[model samples]
Target: MNKTFQYVSYLWDEQKAKSLGDDQVALLIYRSNILGADLRITNYGGGNTSCKTIEKDPLTGKDVEVMWVKGSGGDIGTLTKSGLAALYVDKLRALEGIYRGIAHEDEMVGLFNHCIYDLDSKAPSIDTPLHSFLPFKHIDHLHPDAAIAIAASKDGEKITAELFEGQIAWVPWQRPGFDLGLQLRNALDANPGIRGIMLGGHGLFTWGDTAYECYINSLEVIEKASAFLATNYGKKRPIFGGEKIKSLVGSQRKEQAARIAPLLRGLASSYSRMVGTFNDSDTVLQFINSHDLSKLAPMGTSCPDHFLRTKIAPLVLDIPASQDLSDLGAVKSHIEKLFADYRDGYKKYYETHKRHNSPALRDPNPVVILWPGVGMFSYAKDKQTSRVASEFYINAINVMRGAEAVSEYVSLPLQEAFDIEYWLLEEAKLQRMPKEKALSRKVALITGSAGGIGKAIADKLAEEGACVVLTDIDEDRLANARKDFGKDAAIAVKLDVLDNDTIGQAYKAACLAFGGVDIIVNCAGLAISKPLAETTEADWDLLNDVLVKGQFKVSQAGVSILRTQGLGGDIVNIVSKNALVSGPNNVGYGTAKAAQIHMSRLLAAELGPDKIRVNVVNPDAVIEGSKIWEGKWAEGRAKAYGVTVEELPAFYAKRTLLNEIISTKDIANGVLAFVGGLLGKSTGNILNVDGGVAAAFVR
Candidate 1:
């Protein structure tokens, strides 16, 4: 498990990136991406890396253009020439003192660029002023997982002292951007050879004469801390839960793995570059795995940087009860409870420490979790995300478990977490980049997309236009849709929502095919007929899982992709009339539909400020074979309703004031209206394309 530690050698490869006219620019981006890949180092745009070069000022008769920073809204991995924004060091430093009096941060942000009056489309990183303030030519600021993991602990100061042995200075978490930059200036003045500084739970700040030195310092800091934690706690070796009983649980590890891989894929697609799954259920295997599990689970995050990628919690399993439930219901319930507990703990933590200016709480779900005898659950939003979550979990668990042997493990303080969460500087940096421009280069995933509704919506988006990844449960239909649309228009992926893992995989495929995903349409849904009491639990579960739970899982999985892309995105859920208006024989279908509607709304509200938009399309009875109208349903219900096959259209269509069947075109258009931003200031709002069905007044 030993890895080489090198600064100049690891980060200075010319072949890794495209050749640049300015070698400094090329090195800056390459180094940024390398650091970005390590969770212990960065999270979605949290850190900024820059290179300084002297260029003659046109008017000042002196050298300027001291720095080129990572552009706001660009991930380090995908950073491009357009992603590196420039700032004149002279202007930045002089302007710094000018905006000091501005109380509002946002207003102060405007001042950073005020001195240089020009139409600069790209907003400078919030740290522009700080970069201006720094004398170092190469600066790297990261929320390294190991350093912060120790820094966030109860005795962070003490533990950090022991780990680094006075190699670096430490600062309490301060609001990043201007204030922290000023504080860092003070720290730098105090400690001369301090290669790095830990900002409590926030992250780490490091600088050197070049990108090579900065990156090397980042890697060395984490490696040293990891070594300390391992030496202290690695000897514990093992931990255990309830013993598995064989009779009740026939080894379904393969089956479980098969079932979960797609779900994990879906979750992973939402965040990373790739994803992988592993499952094992042999009692012997479980025992073998227990030692590592015990060591890692109790350990806090490998480092605070891991938090941005994997979150602060992992799913733990109680072995005995897992075998009792024979069906997926039990598994779903068990997993749900773990996520719920994590969320609850997060909220309680927030309440305890949010003395004032508490920001909105992040979703409590663990990015990665362990399934005990069943192995592990790597819940990433994408492939690279999967890697990020998996690696961080392993490291965090290893470190924390090791620390427990020497001392009680403690988490980063709540206030420190808050500082990272609502650090206005990071938010401001994200705000600088344009939303449309940020998402312009990425791909998207759209489900329930054959012909009619899904097709039309997809087409509209393609025209707008985006690289669309389309999917549906219908194999033949999906094939035809692809043929007609052409491969250039969209890549058709056959997906079954019933299989959670498949849906996950579909999302991953979409992301891989197209650098990243920018939008997701949970259009895969169906209507089942049955009286309320007569609807069997099986029926209820089937429809509910497909419509409600399916959407939930997909959205949850897609979040990381959207966030990582840096540009916020849009999610459109195609709901039904049953959600808004009750109808006979719509039991299980209606219930699930209702949940989908509310879920979309809640997500819209929660993700709004992040620049993500969520909305729903509730269309009334659409025409047969016309997207929302499944022709098969008409055949089954025709006999039950005592209506001729010919009369079904009239029977359904007459319910609307327009007296016309809602076509797939109408439903799809309504969905596009929201996602395309046609309807302004209308988020979390439902648009009913029921042919004015509500105006009909069902007697």
Candidate 2:
């Protein structure tokens, strides 16, 4: 149960599972997590595992068997006890008596709820019957690329028979439901001593007497398939029948990817707004550059799990690496034409395969797109989904490679694929998905993001479901601030808005990280307080550079990307109340703030034609967490007001019309009001987050 092989790692620690003692469900979770850890075993959320145990029935006060399987939409790698669905084993068996036949198998799914052993258990998955009907105490069902490579080959059934030599049986593709579960039970009955089944055009199923045995059985089968594929793969010359168009160099590869990412993201979001993930690993490049890419790509993925993540097939752009990318006009035109054709093709596919009971046609856009030399692009509702979709396609590529090396690769027949895609059950699961966040699929970039107000805005946007780019001149704080956000939610860049190169580089990073930016919060600034008599040339230049010039360059950069996406966007500038109020000892800082205010109005007027909204938030006397208040500005302001620095918060509050102290979060909320689709219609306007000093009120 705990032996290692040259192919797959044996991750099960005997002490770990044994430590659980009598907790059989905990043991299953331990086994499932280890198996799901390896991509060679299964892609994210692609596999499920189960165990059966005897527990006293609350009503009968007698010991009864209960089957615990992974719950609907749960990921094995991250599964918890709450994520497993528990049903009475005997109740599951009783359903067979009422089951009409294969035609009525779907109705059995509804019947599964009646078999619940515990009222609080998670909702059952469709594969419940397969695990319940099986005689084994422990079972693992997985869609490992290595095994699917063998299962999806043209001679898969023949090869499975020859390789395992009666140790394993083959089950032709069948939709996972009560009917397939019955078939699995029948297979076990016929094979007598067989350990597992190679599910044709799908995946593998392995069973054992216990959790440890089941874990080992799953690994052993996958390892053998992997070793066989590796050996056959090396013997075969020039994988995928040699390379066609060469892969672009690393620099050119990323350059091209970043350049086309926005356009492609916009095109892919035709059906609905979607986030995108790009991958250019060596594995991806090899497949993308292969000679048989054109021939094999259109054949699509074989595994149902892969098909669900990726669409019927990826849209392959035949642009060679040698093609000129300097002028994007021609490239854009060609891309548009291909997109039109792809939509038409997808509609026809739906028309040809749809049945009377089929669910309505969903998004016709391709989930994946193959750009040779540029890498793979996958789109979905959010970053994680897009990233997971990309991983699934890479698994599909591995499946295609192994199948072609050993035997001709074959995808699931289109009819079978349509049946699963349009299945009412699948549609129901889709309907059950949680509603997306207001800012979901939108990406935001905030300058001085490591600073107080900037960080607040960054966190707020990310919380509202937008991917965020945190840019700051403070390298240490920038790095540390990003730690608070999830990997899929944020990226940090050390950007100095004074430098045009850094300004452009930040946008490039933002595009590469999250496809492109939809919200730009210009919050980078430093304050200076100097009387006319004491103000120096250097003071004037510094305030102008960081405040007025900095915001201008950053806003200019963000607008370029937003325009390219052709999607209306929001630009929120964090200015100061000093711009509207005339105060002693604030000549330089106030002038810079005035410039920022007018500039926002200018840009808002110009960019309105492009459907881009530019607004401003003016904050005043914010002492806590303000980088400006940490230096000479606070000392000067305190000296000017004849009050101690410690009393600044109270002093600012007392002067306000409402006598309220504004925090960094308050400023963040002001920015959100503009970009969060609340006050989205109003632009070239200002929202004051200050305590409402009468002198600063706009007339």
Candidate 3:
């Protein structure tokens, strides 16, 4: 009947638990999902949960106690049964007999594989020992911002003692490993009936005799810590002192962010190409515009999870927030200077602390960049990683806000941070990752992507690992077009190529969502079939406007973004076989196609110096899955050929040498053939996907 505390609440669904019945692991998963669902409780993949249960031993045909814990690289929020690693509880505890000290902590991680009770279990993580050595049956080790705020504060232990009054225990800073596990065990032994323990500058560890009880315990601890921070909220100016710079008003911040993101993206990708994500949320702006930003940012983050993802600290650009950043060249020059210094500082940091056996120096570029007024920009190998990196820094910002509001925010010391960053085990994990996709770091913008050949082209590029920007004049159609891709994969924008402003706006959206464009696809077009005598002025204008002018505007905008990124790019134009073959009732459409073909060749020649390749794809008789064939274009073409609409596929096929009908998917494969790395060195070439239309062949 009584709620435990304010600032956070419990979320135990009794009916949901009843449905799960007596399955312990299912209950554990239910609990983990609920805890990870709230950012106030934990962030994506920030924590691990485990529960001890009785399982039938596969080899011995006997029941034994086992521990099912979240495995490596798995997110608690989206975890499945396969993501759980089942280990022998008795075998895990037995490792203490041959236990080595802190220096040999990494060996403990290797030993976890030996304790695997299930042959199909996922690989164990470094936190395995921490969960196993604990005395309770169910444990929740979480990086909740509220609890970490107290844990990461300088006076954390004292603050926790005064608030919890021995109901919780505090252990000083230590990396998560075998030694930390032993320390957690010792603290629980000393405190007897204490419900939880706080790991200084790290996170919280709460346990219960059962799965549901463990969930409630974690909720209670986090809620109390949050309420305490709120009560201390009377210490006004909950920033790093106060605002030192004036943040840009309204949309100005994002406009500046959009313009500046590509420049920063290019700079960040110097060592290896990367995708970027930008954030200007109020929390980010507050930190960026604060007076103590310069002082506090350099201290870095305290949580190891934050430290690993963001590195030691971010490169904070100290521009007066109100200063006009519209001139990209000016902004680039200023940032270039700051970037060089940051690179030098990073190299110095590595050299200062690195041991002889440390792994080789990594890319000196910063993962996180703080822009006053413009907010935060984070870069990584791809969109999802870049996006998650930004979120981690935001988590750090919240941690800092709470800690600074109560006590000085303290980060992990430099030596400890370095040890974890370059550890041999961490290096091994990095080396074990799979090879990158052909277009892994590339971003593509495809026009007319609502359906048919345009949609097919977008899917092809995305399949090869490129982030896609789906644009079409029909906004409603664009929504359905983008439904299949995740936020990190594709974004839909209403773009009418006739309007140069809409063209510019779409490029801006791509730059904001995926750093910049690396591939431009001109697939948006229409067809008209009428004799010269029957063709009206409006028909001629419509064909040329949508085909000729549209390709120019879209390609021109794409070339600008590619130039800004300084990364070589590809532009694929989907022309028609009619561009080369002269057929009756195709005068306006054929002329527009011819212009598009020649323009590709001309632009290919001009843009070669910029490392931009332009290629043309000619698709013929692609009636299936094409929006163009759904209306007058198909009817008009059918009438001109003296055949019913249903007979067009066979009629067109009979005209070709191969007598094979083409589908929209075949056209998509043609686009992929051009953009995929197999043609990395070829450009200005036209490939015909028309089943051998000899008249349309290139001479």
Model 2's alpha-carbon lDDT is: 0.88
Q: Clashes in model 3: which pairs?
A: none
Model 2 misplaced regions, further than 4 Å: none
> What TM-score would you give candidate 1 relative to the actual structure?
0.53
What TM-score against the true fold does each predicted structure earn?
A: 0.53, 0.98, 0.97
RMSD of each: 12.6, 1.5, 1.7
Best by lDDT: 2
Which runs in model 1 stand beyond 4 Å of their true positions? Answer: 1-11, 14-22, 37-46, 58-61, 94-110, 115-121, 126-130, 149-165, 213-233, 236-254, 257-326, 329-371, 375-408, 419-699
lDDT of 2 by residue, 1-699 (tens): 449687777898878877899799999999888988888898899878999999999999999999999998899988889999999999998998998998887788899999999888888988999899888899999998888999999999988888888888999888899988889989989899999998898899999998888988998898888888988985767789887777888878887887788888888887787888888999998998888898998888889889888988999987776567666676888998888898999899999999998998889898999898779989898899999999999999999999999999999889888888888888988899888898998999999999799999998999999999999999999999999999799989989989988887788777677778889999998887878999999999999999989998899878877877788799999999999999889999999999999999999999998899999999987677878898788889988999988888899899899899999989988888898777878999999989787887777
lDDT of 3 by residue, 1-699 (tens): 335546555677899999999898898898898888887888788899999998889889899989999998788887878999999988998999888788888888889899999888988988888898886889999998988999999889999998999989999999888888889999989988998999998899999988888988898889889888888753765567878778888678777777777888888888988898988899898888888788889999988888788888999876665567566776678888888998999999999999898999998899999988778999999998888888889989989989999988898889999998998888877886788888888888999999989998888888889899999998999999899887789999999999998998998898888888888999998887888999999999999999999999899878877888887889999999999999889999999999999999999999989889999999998887777888888888999999999999999999999999988788888888888889988789899999999999899
Task: State the TM-score for model 2.
Answer: 0.98
Candidate 3 to truth, TM:
0.97
- Candidates sorted on TM-score, descending: 2, 3, 1
Candidate 3: regions farther than 4 A off: 1-6, 234-238
- Which structure is stronger by TM-score: 1 or 3? 3
- Candidate 1 lDDT, 296-395, residue by residue in tens: 4544453444565666556565544234433444555555565567667767766776646544554545556566555555654333345545555554
